[model samples]
Target chain A: MKAFISKNKWTLLLLIAATALMLVLAQKTYYALIIALFGIYAIVATSLDVLFGYTGQISLGHAGLFAIGAYSSALLTIKFGVPSLLSLVLGSAITALIGALIAIPASKLVKHFLSLLMIAFGQIIYLIINSWTEVTGGSLGIMNIPYLNVFGFEVNSNLKGAIVIWVILAIVLLVKHRIIRSRVGNAFIAIRENTVAARGLGIDVQKYKVLAFAVSAAMTGLAGGLYAFLRGFISPETFNGTQSVLFMTMLLFGGITTLAGPVIGAIVLLLFKEVFQTFSTYQGLIYALFMLLVLFFFPNGIIGLYKSGKTAVMKLLSKRAEATRNGGAENAEN
Target chain B: MLKIDHVSMVFGGLTANNDVCAEVHKGEIFGLIGPNGAGKTTLFNVISGFYKPTAGKVIFNGEEIQGKLSNQIAQKGIARTYQNINLFKKMTVLENVLVGCHTQTRANIFDAIFNTKRSRAEHEEAIRRCREVLEFMGIGHLEDSLAGSLPYGDQRRLEIARALVSNPKLLLLDEPAAGMNLTEKDILTDTILKIRDLGYTVLIVEHNMKLVMKVCDRICVLNHGNKLAEGTPEEIQNNPDVIKAYLGGAK
Candidate 1:
């Protein structure tokens, strides 16, 4: 426990500091709204990391999953009068089922083809939303989503709403941390590293691939439900291919390889957009520029860059130590 | 414990394995030797469930497993190493072995997310078993190192350790002595024999006759995807047909 704590102290410290910052920002509900938005994106991106980073699957269709959650939650509350929490769970489940179904056929393709398939799925979902006027309210989308009532604790203000969203995000992050060291995590990484080798070890590769889809979609769906309720409105335009690309960008920019990569990525990109809102007309160009820069400089993501920096510094120090030992000692590993 | 009855694997027009028949009995080190393009690796693929056989049956422990997925076959107490060293390159040596324990573990998604007692127990048990396997394979100190960074011989040992962690009833080693020096081959020969002592039925494929002749209890020679001959190593060394196809008339 001592060694584990020492090794991960920075991560734990960053986590606590982020929480404190969130609480301080909660004082201004307007700021809380943006924070809540950041939290929501973090949830979505973190789930995407589970697919892209650990499982080596890519889905540009996540925005479709996001839309499904939003519409299901809104429809359930508006049309069926279901409780907000129950509807959220049901919405997530429906999204997961859809994701699993899509994964079956999608998994047959290789590399960029799989991503293209996801993009196609996202387009199909957007088209459905646009054409299915009776259910989806067409391009105008559903409006007046009810505020959450968590056991009668009304989340009517941005402060309460932001707190709830961040709380969910924190729980999701913790859950991800736990899962990344567990058996299921190993299987996911194994499949990512080598599918043939994973199969040789007795892992049901297809089943696990579907499971990654279901889990990723389920989380993205939950974030969507929260987004719908928080904003009290959602549109088909918001869940388009562009939005899916934005989500993937956030994951890549922050660091897909680390536990905090998606969270940091989401927060950075979301805040970056907000800060440059005056140039919102050039948002796509800005995103593309940022993506190209990151790709050129930090292909492994920001966390990956930091890891490389650390290694270089450690190597320098170790070489100095070796010099003192008459240059006979073996170089350090790790 | 493994019987392949006329297993034939065809890749479009190419028959990689054609009507190969062999039985690997329990408590023996059975070696499959052949020259290049002789389908020794294809037969391993057939038994390990990588390629679906176009023709006949693979019976293991009296259970038919011809049409099963590779993972399904692995779950039925069969583990295998590759001809190419296919370790999870970025993962730690310990992690590589732990992944091999996937089939034996019982933790589900809920267990993982919640860090349930059942999950923790299984995880700890798997770690313990992985460590033991690493030690047995004589690479215990490399547990924290990345698998790809290990020396070639240690990497090979790590692969074996990973396979051994599953407590497989049958282990298939494809060219275990490939690229190894004479001393390394000698140690690998000892290790294969020791693994057999642990009650595992080992079916090894190798081009190196010195190691095969030293370790394998029985030998099956393959040529052009066909089982050419099966006999003891002494019998195989003297057999003119085996010598012609693989040994190139060498004594």
Candidate 2:
């Protein structure tokens, strides 16, 4: 129990903090909705980190994958009369399959070519959703998507949605943490740091790259499925290139390769955007400037900044302790 | 255990290795030595499956392995270090070695996600093996430190440790003694011999003649991408062609 707590202290603390925030904002329906939205976006950012941060691959087409999940789930529930939970699973699984297919070609390419391919992929998906008026409802997306039902209880309220989303997010984060510390996660990092060395050491780089893509897509797809249920609607506009870029931005802003980075990044950036909605025209400019500033100052992201700050404080404390010890020795000699 | 049969690697008008042929018998320390631009590293690349040879075959344990992917070749029990230290710098030394254990362990995504008993056991076993290898390389205490933070010699040893953890049949060391002091070189020589004593074949490429002569049971010389000499160290040392190639003339 002691070892478990020590290992999971941060996770425990985050859960407590989230629960407290939920209680404090219990009466504010708008804030609760925003928090729920943050949970969804945070899931996307964390999924992106699995590829971009750990595996050192880029995908600007995540918005497309997200759209696939949302549409599939919404359509399944509305048209096929499938249960909400089953649709969510099926939708994410479909996204995972598509992600693996994309990775087959993407894994063979490197750097700029990979990024360009992803951009084209996103554009293609967006175009399909935009023009396919028959099934996707075209620009006019499907509405009144059913809310998630758990054991016959309807998650219709924002508070209940937030609870469900956070629970899922917590599980995602825990699973990610386990994988990162495991042998499989090591292979991902090995590919990221040095592909040649990784290959020489017997790691199947191509296979792992595809695995990273599939896993990342599955998580992002889950987020999209949850988003559709929470908002009761999702349009192609919500999963455009700009939205994809926003997910990347959140990952970068929070810091990549760290679990806390994505959640903090999603919550902070979403809140910031909400606050700046009054100046809607300049919101993009303001966001860009803020990202630039953060990148310039903290290249590793906010978590990195916190880490370095912590080390600095620890260093100062150690130095003070050493100085006091030396002074005491001198007084004894006197 | 390994044969380089008429291997020739040509890169767009430049012959990095021309008709290079050599054989490494199992459990012996084989050395490939030459001056700069002599294609020693290129030949290592060919053997390790980094570059498919323009011509010829690389046979290991009686099976031809040319043109195969590097990871496939590695899975066939051939591990190699780089001329330049290639380590996952940001990762801890233990993590770096654990990656080398990838082929040995087999817990899939489902196992990792669910934290199954098999995954936990495999993980613990991998860690134990990594620790054992680090201890062998004399870096057991530094396992928690980042690979990038180690001193130059330790980084080199860490690379060797990473390679060794994979439990390859043939170990290739590229300039293992490069950038090392005389004492470190002596230690490396001992380590190489010890590795050989453990029934593993070693193929080394080095510029340090003294260490090569001291450690290698046999040496092959390359000049201008062609084989100049292949013999016991004493035979290579006495050969006029080898001396002329090294000194640019027979003195």
Ten-residue stretch with the least lDDT total in model 1 chain A:
A325-334
| Candidate 2 wrongly placed segments (more than 4 Å) | A3-15
Best by lDDT: 2
True contacts kept of 1: 0.90
TM-scores of all predicted structures: 0.94, 0.97
Q: Candidate 1's C-alpha lDDT?
A: 0.90
Candidate 1 segments whose C-alpha is farther than 4 A from its true place: A1-14, A313-334, B247-251
CAPRI-style quality class for the chain A–B interface of candidate 2: high
lDDT of 2 by residue, B1-251 (tens): 89999999999999999998999999999999988999999999998999999999999999999999999999999999998999999999999999999888998888889999999998999899999999999899999999999999999999999999989999999999999999999999899999999888999999999999998999999999999999999999999998899888855
Q: Which ten residues in a row have the lowest lDDT in candidate 2 chain A?
A: A281-290
Q: Give each prediction's root-mean-square deviation over alpha carbons.
A: 3.7, 1.7
Per-residue C-alpha lDDT of model 1 across residues A138-210, encoded as one tens digit per residue:
9888888899888898789898988899889988888888888889989999999988999999999888899
